[model samples]
Target: MTEEAQRRLLVELGASLFQRGYSVGSAGNISIRLEDGYLMTPTNSSLGRLEAARISKLDRDWNHVDGDKPTKEVFLHRAFLDARPEAGAVVHLHSTYATAISCFEEAVIPPLTPYFVMRVGRTLPLIPYYRPGNPEMEPAVHAAAKGAKAVLLANHGPVICGATLIDAVNAAEELEEAAKLALLLRGMSPRLLTPPQVDDLLTTFG
Candidate 1:
């Protein structure tokens, strides 16, 4: 897609996620990899109100080249994007259920459904808490991204990446649903996808 098209799509997707409550206020950021650089939601900008033309542009080395300043959490996206060559987009959101799950003792969200395993891969590692926007979290996130498509930031939220913007958004949505399911099934033994079932999904869909 052309740069213009990517900008428009970022605005559209950001609005959709915001309107649906996936992000509130200026609490989330989205970034798309470009041939020349990247297009990212501006810092302090509400996803619901993004102007395509004003989205922050970063050079290949991550310097701010145009538009407003990029989110301070640019390093968060960079960690994943740099680690995974196939990842073309990264989404970080403070969605409720997912954030709640992050606060729990377990560092990983268990496989509760076939779709969760299929969409988010085999595991969702939890990165130890780092204050939001702190560059200190980058190394941990990068290391976790080496093996997982998504990771839950302890007491914060989720960071998800995919080969395309749509794929990343879809995975984020699925992750939120999986978190909801886990919360609802907590304290109750719920049927989970067995090892063979997870393997089958991975083999068939991956």
Candidate 2:
């Protein structure tokens, strides 16, 4: 796709997430890989109010080359993109329930539903927390992202990747929903999808 089209798509998707409360204020960032570089949401820009023409553009070396400045958490997106060449886009957000799940001792959300198992995969890595924008967490995120579809940041939120930009947004939405379900069933003995069930979903989805 052309850069202009990608920028518009980001604006559309970002607005969708924001209107649904998946993101608030200037608390989230989105990016798509490009043949020569990348296109990312600008620093401190509200996803609900993204200006497609002003989306930040970065060169192959990650240097900002046009439009607005990119998010300070560029390290978060870079880690996943560099680690997984197949990851065409990344979406990082501080959605409510998913952030709550990050604080749990569990490293991953249980297989609560077939759609969750299909979109998020079986192992969701939880990275130790770092102050927002700290590059110190890059190595850990990079390593884990190599083999996982998504990772939760302790006391923070989720970083999801996909083969396409919309896929990333969809997975991000699914994760938040699953997290919400997990919280609702917190005190109850919910029947989770069994190992074989999860495996079947993965095979079918794949």
Candidate 3:
């Protein structure tokens, strides 16, 4: 996509996520990998009201090049993109259900449905907590990304990567639904997909 197209799509999708309550009060960030570098939401910018031309642009080395300043949580996105070269986009959101699950000791939401396995993979590890906006969390996130496309930031939210922006957003949404299901099914023996079933889904859809 052209730079302008990517910027427009980012704004459109960001607004959609924000309007749906996936992000609120500028509590989330997004970035897309570009052939030249990256385009990220500006710091302190509301995802619901992004200006396409004012989105921050960074060089391949992450140096700010144009538009507004990038989000302070740039390292979070960097961690995922660096670890997964195939990833074309990264999304971080403090969605309610996913964030609530992050607070628990068991961070890995089980495969309660086939879609969860198809979109979010087999396991979602909980990265050790780090103060918000702290670059120190990058290494931990990067390490976890080696095994999974998504990881819940303890007490923070979820960071997800995908081959494209839509895929990343879809995975995040699926994760949120799965988290909600897990919470709703608490204390009940909900029928979950068998390992063989999960393996088949991963093989077919992943």
Query: In lDDT terms, which candidate is top?
Result: 1
Question: What TM-score does structure 3 among the candidates reach?
Answer: 0.98
* Local lDDT at 184 for model 2: 91
Model 1 sits at a Cα RMSD from the real structure of 0.8
Better of 2 and 3 by lDDT: 3
Ranking by lDDT: 1, 3, 2
Off by over 4 Å in 1: none
| lDDT of each residue in 40-151, candidate 1, tens digit only | 9999999999999999999999999999999999999999999999999999999999999999889556788878898899989999999999999999999999999999
Per-residue CA lDDT of model 3 for 1-206, tens digit only, reads: 88889899999999999999999998999999999999999999999999999999999999999999999999999999999999999999999999999999887688898888988998798998899999999999999999989999999999998899999999889999999999999889988899999999999988
Candidate 1 collision pairs: none
Residue 72 of model 3, lDDT score: 96
Kindly list the per-residue Cα lDDT of model 2 for residues 1-206, writing each as its tens digit: 88788988999999999999998999999999999999999999999999988999999999999999999999999999999999999999999999999988784588899888888899899999799989999999999998898999999899999999999999999999999998998988999999999888888896
Write the number of the candidate with greater TM-score, choosing between 2 and 3: 3
TM-score of each: 0.98, 0.97, 0.98
